[model samples]
Target: MANKTLVPQAKAGLNKFKMEAAKEVGVNLTDGYNGDLTSRQNGSVGGQMVKKMVEQYENNL
Candidate 1:
């Protein structure tokens, strides 16, 4: 799959946000490949990210 972002400059910002979410969820997520992690753990991180994004958006409404 291609990890293409429309705003290339926002890639770093997105990564930073992902890292923050991982930390909040107690996920020892590292930079680069994380194939060592279990699917459940990875899914939790992604879910947490989306939850946070939605909260932020709602708050700004």
Candidate 2:
């Protein structure tokens, strides 16, 4: 079976969010495909996104 998003409609927004996070963390992410990035660089971008999400959640609480 294939995995699916809980909210499929938000996919586009999430992609945009990821791109913004990459830019903020100094990772050069391009549109379309980005399978060439190093693990460290990708991990940094993901980490920054989680950090920002947590901060936003806390602020809203």
Candidate 3:
């Protein structure tokens, strides 16, 4: 299957979550577009978001 989000309706929420994750990880993020950011900076933000999500899931379990 083509890669796509399961919950397309949650795109806005996910964007908000991403911004929060970026802030928490000290990555400067802005709305609209962010193509100026370096790959490492973007990767760290994603990594931090995944780490936080996993922690939250484990805590709930």
What is the model-wide C-alpha lDDT for candidate 2?
0.93
Overall lDDT per candidate, in order of appearance = 0.94, 0.93, 0.93
- Candidate 3 lDDT over 1-61, as tens digits, reads 9968789998899989999999998988999789999999999999989999999999999
- Which stretches of model 1 miss by more than 4 angstroms? none
**Candidate 2 ranges with C-alpha deviation above 4 Å:** 1-3
Q: Which digits, one per residue and each the tens of the lDDT, describe model 2 over residues 5-36?
A: 67999988988999999999999999867899
Model 1 per-residue lDDT tens digits across residues 1-61: 7979989999999999999999999899999889999999999999999999899999999
Alpha-carbon deviation at 56 in model 3, angstroms = 0.8
Candidate 3 overall lDDT versus native:
0.93
What's the TM-score of every candidate structure? Answer: 0.91, 0.86, 0.85
Work out candidate 3's RMSD over C-alphas.
Answer: 1.7
On the 0 to 100 scale, the lDDT of residue 61 in model 3 is: 100
